[model samples]
Target chain A: MSNNNYVKNLIESGMRIDNRKFDEFREIEIKTNIIDRAEGSSIIKIGNTQIIVGVKLSVGEPFPDTPDEGILIVNAEFSPAASPSFEAGPPDENAIELARVVDRAIRESHCIDLKKLCIVPKEKVWNINIDIQVIDFDGNLIDAACMGTVAALKTTKIPKYENDEVDYEHREGELPLVDLPIYVTIYKIGDKLFVDPTKEEEEAADARISIATIQDGKICAIQKGGTGYFTISEIERAIEMSIIIGENLRNLFKH
Target chain B: MKEKEKLIINRKRLDGRDLYEMRKIEIQINPIKNSMGSAMFKFGKTWAIAATHGPRAAYPKWQQNPEFSILKTRYMMLPFSTWERSKPGISRRSIEISKVVNDALSNVIFLEDYPKTMIDVFIDIIEADASTRCAALNAASIALALAGVPLKDIVSSCSVGKIDGEIVLDIAGFEDNYGEVDCAVAMIPHEEKVLLLQMDGIVTKEEFKKMIMLAKEGCLKVYESQKTAIKQAFTNIIDIE
Candidate 1:
């Protein structure tokens, strides 16, 4: 089937190939503490697609531009084994895009208080690496990766350090660095927008937009993808929907 | 060094379980509502979740045997599951286990009942210990059962190994590293049929037989525990008096 025909059929049915409405999402399942070695880790399943996010922390010099603040690096990789289209070696455009979308959502929202991450001013600060891996590609990998990243961050705890020597005791006293920042992605297929597109919808999608919002209805980041275009009104509608979706997602992490 | 000498010297294990004992096993089913079936299985420090989806229609143009169903399995471990950071992906080890699990499950699933349909079983390991793969397979089986997938029988799995040259029922991280032999077995308790078996390291045929027998015994125990978990889950939904 040609790509154009696929899109036409999908829009006409008001459903993606997987039978999900444009506003509907593939079933989502989130599991935290899936990674024991990382400070925080989570796995998000959106339909058959799976993404695992792990957060690791290290003490390092802060970036020159933000010397007083800590650093947050988001790296995303799509394993060649995940799908036939993903090749080995450096990240492809899709993987890079996934990382940028997730990173922008979290970083732009200032999910973690960078100042708190700083321990010795410019000399040493916490470098939080959020690594996302696409384990399976059934569809909508970016949304799943972002959700897992936020959940992992929310569940993450930094160890208390005083004199560089490790102290296993007195663990609970140190608080987490920041509140949770949630991400919601909406895909435009035909004339409608879907909350979370499955793999099939993703393949047939004309355009996709992701919005990252903090708790107070503030928009932190926005990303637009695909060869398709959306009108200004469509963009506004997506942002409104994202806020509602983001708030509900935020509540999910609270539990 | 003599085998008996090695066994006598190492009296204490890392986690302190007895040689013949198994790790504490905790199984939770339907932790998530959206999936057809979902389960979290913990064996001591190791943890994993399994989600089952569909007897949904198979994709067009894929290999289809009209008389049987297709079972697809994916096993993955999160980077945080280990002491060292791991990249998220389907590693070779996980892929091998996926194949084994698919093979094991096919034996018990009444595939002919769901012709031209597909069942996708996904197992994600959140924490890692020595026997994560076996735990994943067991958890997947339980999740499938909870999902109410038609099956000839429910399956359970366990591992046994020779640690310090002594036959141990289940080997944790420390023991797994120093152990001389490792064997994992998946079985259908009611049928007393072994569906999958894997072993590594060195052991005589006699020892292999013993290890397999012990693993089967352990699998039976696991099966009973899984049954109890399933019953509890259903009872929780019964609108109890």
Candidate 2:
């Protein structure tokens, strides 16, 4: 039997290959301040999937449109170390999509107080760059990457800037974060919908949707991926699951 | 922003459209004779042309599948499409859009019939005023059908947004730049299911649901227009014969 059929058969019978509930997530581990050179850094492991995220702050001129707000850039690299499919060149479509989805979650949630990062309106502002590196290949990279990024951002500190120069050694204030946005991705396999699929389950998914929600249960960003279709009821169920799972994930930051 | 002008004044948008009104849409079939199928779709100021090429044998050999054909789509915006000349090359944004558009149309096309083949869809935006992806998909769907490609259902798409505390439909022009939230949706009307969905910006859960419904209504309207254009094209061909 093919992997798709085997996975589908298992899911149809309310069984996942990893033997977890449909909405259950694998064990997650997060460690912060792992990189001394970066302003902030974290490594997150969700099941077998491991990702390292680093946050860097630099002074630069703002974009022409939103000059008064600080800039937030997200980039993701799927290193060859993580999987045999990955290459050592520029980012691929999946990497680009991963970065953009995480970017939308952060930007749309209004989590970071961008205006507060502005040093000189329209002229100079602090640019926050979040770089996500995949160290292990597994399923649910989107959720893992988002969690790694948020944890890294939470630990980021602003470096001291004086006399048109940045003094990296004298870091002072923390990143102006007012809210936390948690991302949840649900995969639809056959007639069932589940969260946190393993790598094998991901290969069998017919469709998937990633949603980002804030503390108030307000949706900030959504991306429906894959070639399969979904009914309205399925979409609604996905939203409900995301909100419930997002709340649980947010509690991880209470410490 | 306190002193900034409102996007909607007395329920009228900047382009004289109401809260749920869509801009005028026009579609022309087989605009490029050299290709297997081609179409031009316009939504007010935004224009997209799509060309469908062969179920030709897949190149590089390794990319071909023994069981089914592969579908590839490329979406590009001309340098002069925007106010500021966009750089002439593929950007990450275009790459992502292409992938989504490909996926949106993938299930609808009957790829199993053509083994070891590839169907290529090229969409170019000659003009842009937001919602370019929706317009491009509309054109591609029609072009594929005209090219003798079998499809289960036609795909239609539209976008809705939140601006000035009100959910509105068919967001265009300056509304995209100033809107608080934007949601684009594509649907297969016959199947009664959504094929594509994407959103950015902020909105309450209630408003998000409203946006999806409103965008669906807008897509149905586009579907009506597509039906008329396709019928007219066939009628023209019959008259010629």
Candidate 3:
């Protein structure tokens, strides 16, 4: 189905599929330390959607290009178990896009001081692997996953090392990553713009734009997806809305 | 004593657990605002998340049973969850586990209360160590509880394994791989009822009996932990009652 009528009905009523107003986001809930084995982990909930992110660390040779800095890899998997549409195999394009967008937000925002991950100069650096698993898909997985990732990273503590071995038993201090970055996704349905579209709105909307912002209000990354195109003015409007949402989210991580 | 020395001298055994041993266990729960319930579980690094959606309508004509509510389960692991990520869709292992979890849970749920409705349980494993399937079953039970889905019982589960020729409770990833026998059980403590019982590898009937006893002990311990967590979750909220 084209969902044209559904989109038109929602737009005409000045409401979203989930009955949210134009600029409102879905309800969000965050919980950390849900994964006991992960160095840092968080589960994020946006309405009916759920994403779990686990952060694990190990020592490995840094990339030759970024030998002085640590390496961060973000992998997002939308399992078939999450939804009926999701197929069995390697992550398809949707999963890849989700991971890349989230990766860019964190990396571009310079949330973690990659240099601090260095264990022994150019020889070894902490390889941080962020694994994101989508356990349920109601809608708007990107925002939920990104938020969960950032929260997990914020709570992460790189264990102290001495004499080429991790001091697992003894405790040293924690080094919190520097900046906190957040992402907000907006969907355009007809002439109306909606923040944090639900699965229904997401299915009905013509085009979607996700904008990630750092605390400084700088655009870290922007991805425009779906079949529809937006006017430059709409893009500007989305950015402004994202900034407001990002600021609100920034306050959330402060605690 | 001399036989003990022989086992430890080379630090190797038919089953790998040292004396006074247990397996690694991991637990996680994601509160998905979108879903009715959600949780992740890891046993010896075998990871799975259970998500529940709806006491909604029953779909497809034949699948519905009017006398009792339906419990539909899908158990799957992402390709990346294992050392080698498997195919994404329903694998044989997942299908089997789904059936096992469904059977385990059906015994505890009062399905007759919600006739004609359907409760869907989806479990996805992001990684596997050992006892992943059993851990997933435990996680589903907790997630359902968190969702506030009424049930007649709280199902708790764990695994027991034999290593170094002795029974050990809760096999960790390493111990499970090298252990002689692995047995997973799900039970309702209040009823003292066993829902699911599965075993693999090697063990005599006597050893199997011992393993069941040990697994039950582990299950009780896990049940206590689950209670603590549930209490803690609700502690801060104002009690309506």
Candidate 4:
């Protein structure tokens, strides 16, 4: 059977290959502070797919427009070793998109108190680098990456600095984290919406909408991907699903 | 860490495991359907997954050998697998590990049976505490067997090393970093053939002999798990026709 048939059969029969109900997400495993050298790091596994998110801190000049605020840079690398389909090269479109969606969740939500990161207004500020890597591509990378990033940044530590120089060996304090951003993605297949599609389901999905919500179920970011169209009713239902499902994921992932 | 207690105290290593104890080993085959064969191999906190594809015609055509099939392998650790986030990609370290793993499998596989074809194995690390290369080799062996690839025997591998002046079996991640020596051994237990043998750090001749013996014992235990894993996967896979 073709990929389409495989998915259709499952939908017709109910549940996924792993026997998960259509609306249910895969089992998630999160481990934070796995990287000692980096200020913060997390490894998240959604079913078989896994992603590593690390936060690196450095001193730099803040953007002119945001002179007193800290900077957040999100970078993603899809390793060829993650899957046969991935190539050895710079970040591809998929990687760039993964980073952007995750970045939007934290940035747009103003999860971090950036102004406190400024050492001197317009002169020096903390440049926070978030690097995400898809180490296993079993699917559902976006949700996992977002969780990893949020968890990592939550645990980030700012290095101690004195006399205008950072002491790389000593950590002074934790980053000023104010809110938690959670992402929930729902994939559409043959009119049905599902949470956390496996790689095969993902390949056959028509379209997917990702919603990022902070505390109190407020939507902060929305991204729609894939070539398929979504009905107005479907979008509404998905947003509802995002809030309900995103809450559960966030609670379970709490540090 | 105290000098004596950091590694070994009363012959028990960190995590309170005996010097001869191996990590808890678990294997799940065919976790993903896209590949011909796949396995999720877990050795305690160190976890890895391997997938095998091919015996298909070699790509680019020119890479095919008329008399034997080519085996391609890639090994990578997740950035969060270690204390520090490692850069993801095929680094010099991974390349070397992949090459050696390929070499270890070459002798056990009946590559000559499938001429003008290629078999690709990819290993992805989820969490690594140490001896990932050996774990990859063991996982790849199960994946190949699950894919119905012809094998002389399923290969089993393990690492032995010296910590606190005693040779130990199945070194964990931290022991690998702080230990004095590491010797990885891969074998076909029934035939008792050493397909791969590599080591690093300083060792005396007597210690080398002892390490190899301990490694062989560890490999045998791993071989039993590989056989049972492949058998279990097939038992659930009933014939359709």
Best by lDDT: 2
What does candidate 2 score in Cα RMSD to the true structure? 2.5
Mark the regions of model 1 whose C-alpha exceeds 4 Å error after superposition: A160-177, B1-241
lDDT, candidate 1, A106-213, per-residue tens: 765666788878787769888889999998998777668888998788777675667874343333323244656666777776668887765666677766666667
lDDT score at residue B185, model 2, on the 0-100 scale: 88
Query: Model 3: residues >4 Å from true position, as ranges?
Result: A2-4, A167-175, B1-241
Q: Higher-lDDT candidate among 1 and 4?
A: 4
What is the CA-based DockQ of model 2?
0.79
Give the Cα lDDT of each candidate: 0.73, 0.90, 0.72, 0.80
For model 4, what is the alpha-carbon lDDT of residue B221? Answer: 91
For residue A129, model 3's alpha carbon misses the true position, in angstroms, by 0.4
Candidate 1, residues B123-162, lDDT tens digits: the string is: 9999988788778887888789889997767778888888
Error of 2 at B49 (Å): 0.6
Query: Which clashing pairs does model 4 show?
Result: A36-B83, B129-B173
The interface RMSD value for candidate 2 stands at: 1.0
lDDT of 2 by residue, B80-159 (tens): 99999999878889999999999999989999999999999999999999999999999999889888899988899998
Quick one: best DockQ, which candidate? 2
Model 4, residue B70: C-alpha shift (Å): 33
Residue-level lDDT of model 2, residues A147-210, one tens digit each, is: 9999999999999999999998889999998889999999997779999988899989999999
| Model 4 TM-score, 2 decimals | 0.52
At residue B52, what lDDT does model 1 achieve? 90
User: What CA RMSD would candidate 3 show?
Assistant: 21.5
lDDT of 4 by residue, A56-112 (tens): 999989887689888999989998999999999987667776777787778767889
Candidate 2's C-alpha runs over 4 A off are: B234-241
After TM-score superposition, what is the CA distance of residue B80 in candidate 3 from its true location, in Å? 30
**DockQ of all models, two decimals each:** 0.01, 0.79, 0.01, 0.01
Local accuracy of candidate 3 as per-residue lDDT tens digits, A1-255 = 567577668676796666678877778889997876678899999888999999988788988757778899999899788889898898765787688778877876778889878877669998889999999898787788889999898778776777887654443545458887787887787667877776667787766777777777766655556534454446557778888888898888896
